[model samples]
Target: MQRIVLERAGGTPVTKRAHLGAVASGNLEVLCEPPAGDGATIVVSTSVDGYEPVWRATLERFLEQHFIAAAIEINDFGATPAMVSLRLEQALELAR
Candidate 1:
């Protein structure tokens, strides 16, 4: 397992918590909650190794578009980049 942590500045704070997706069979789950501060923090735990760059790029693009201030947790199980983005968007939507 590999763990990646990314932090960003500025965004609309998440008022409610959300959980989406599932961690099984090439899928993943996203958990979003109100952050302790004004920025956004994301913690990703993936079954795949040496994919930090991919994870960063995927998440950066999402953050650039949404820019939500929330504590996000991603538990990945060999999920594709597209699936990751989808789950994140879903989690954010549910959070809002």
Candidate 2:
């Protein structure tokens, strides 16, 4: 698993970005960082899916100040975004 940590930068857009995730038996084309000329977007695509609002809420809840310069998207494999975030945190902590 790959992870990134974004530092606090002023003038960040705290608003939610247009993001989506899907789970399927087929392979997925994922972009970790933002598109070219668009800067970076934090994406976390998993093999999980189902609960949308929970993940959205998870993103909203965990979206504190230090996470400003980043945008994340997770493709869950039967995993909620909250679970995604929890896994992410654990992964990140382990990585650290």
Candidate 3:
């Protein structure tokens, strides 16, 4: 599994670690922590890169549709924007 840390340093430190992983044929597995408490904090791994806008947009949309509280970490392994987004949501969902 890989680790992607979305950390905002020197300010309102809000770290989101998205543990991402590969899934069966065109699928993904994601787990997230939104910088809070925890209980068997899940970890996900993925492979989605070079698509910052897509990630950002996807996060926004996912956040809009869900609510999270704790740190989130991501681990990617060559995934597409859509896949990344879906993985992110899945992670968040798992968190919830």
Give me the candidate number with maximum lDDT. Answer: 1
Off by over 4 Å in 2: 1-50, 90-96
lDDT of each: 0.92, 0.41, 0.50
Global CA lDDT computed for model 2: 0.41
lDDT of 3 by residue, 1-96 (tens): 334334222212224455566555566556555555432222334454455655566655654554444455545555666876776666555544
Per-residue lDDT of candidate 1, residues 1-96 (tens digit):
999999998899988999978899899988899999889999999999999999999999999999689999999999999999889888888887
Could you give the C-alpha RMSD of every candidate to the true structure, in order shown? 0.8, 9.5, 6.8
* Global Cα lDDT for candidate 3: 0.50
Whose TM-score is higher: candidate 2's or candidate 3's?
3
Rate residue 93 of model 3 by lDDT: 51
Evaluated at residue 24, the lDDT of candidate 2 is 40
Better of 1 and 3 by lDDT: 1
TM, every model:
0.96, 0.39, 0.49
lDDT over C-alpha atoms for residue 69 of model 2: 38
